[model samples]
Target: MAVKLNTPIKLVLFDVDGVMTDGTIYMAESGEFCKAFNVKDGLAIELLRAHEIKSGVISGKASPALTNRCQKLGFDIIETGCKHKLPKLEQICTNFNVTADAIAFCGDDVLDLPIMERCGLSVAPADAHQLVLEQADWVSAYKGGSGMVRDFVDTLLLSQSNIGLKEIYQPLLRKIALDDLTGVEQ
Candidate 1:
């Protein structure tokens, strides 16, 4: 079944390292960095795109690996090297005209709290920092880089049940057309 959000969960932002990857920074002899991401998490993001909910990535660090992943996942917005995520997230909300309360952010560290507090739904992985887990509205059953994102997305999809009857599935192009009706310029 597909999940459709009228407004409550219009956008979902994710933290790259701890939330998507295992939070390991592998530095090779040539100063190359490598990060391993869960395939299930990638599929979850793509599923959201199919369901009319846009997804974004706001990470505190930058890496070619992260960029490649975002591109492959068809992320609606991607911002890296942002230690302070709230500010960048605010800009994204403004551009898309997404209300603060309609955004859901998933993170796994203390640095993610600022934005987490502002968003309507705050999600944390089971292995998230103590403070982060404390602040989250929902904590995943799975650990980061281990299908945790899939777990979060599943719960979000399930929550749409009480949101009223609507379409169960929306094709990508139709979803994009509906999104334009909102103040989401592009």
Candidate 2:
């Protein structure tokens, strides 16, 4: 079934690496791995939860950090270590008792194609790979691990109802200003 954009979406699915992070993996000599996540994205999830929309993470690689972050973010589901993400997504939809048309999927790489194709609404970050971008229903202006997820969430919220645009955009602008100042300071 095709997703109806104007309807209330029940769930949002995310890809961890490129969609959540900036598509970079940091490995230390101590065998520890890390990925940077945006504070704005976290806030977005919080706002979505407040509005009764559930979120989840689906990734091809399993990372302890990702697990910890998902827990912190209060995600409804976390499916990791799955090379084929579509089956995991299907299972998630089934478990949630929601049809595929009520779900949105965001991703940024070739591996994300299958799930993206299956989702009702598909999104890709501005810096997404060519194939991923081509398949997306929306391409965010912000890069992943920056503010892409937040951007998408805000768009969804606004589409669903009237969220004061200024109120929604102000914090993001403030954060960017702070980041710019911090960069100069460093």
Segments in model 2 whose C-alpha atoms lie over 4 Å from true places: 1-6, 166-186
Candidate 2 C-alpha lDDT tens digits along 57-113? 888888888899999988998888888988888788778898777889999999999
What C-alpha lDDT, on a 0 to 100 scale, does residue 96 get in candidate 2?
88
Work out the TM-score per prediction. 0.83, 0.85
Pairs of colliding residues, candidate 2: none
How accurate locally, in lDDT, is each candidate? 0.84, 0.84
Model 2 collision count = 0
Q: 12 in model 1: Cα distance from truth in Å? A: 0.4
Winning candidate number (TM-score): 2
Q: Quote model 2's TM-score.
A: 0.85
Candidate 1 positional error at 23, Å:
0.6
Model 1 bad stretches (over 4 Å): 1-7, 162-186
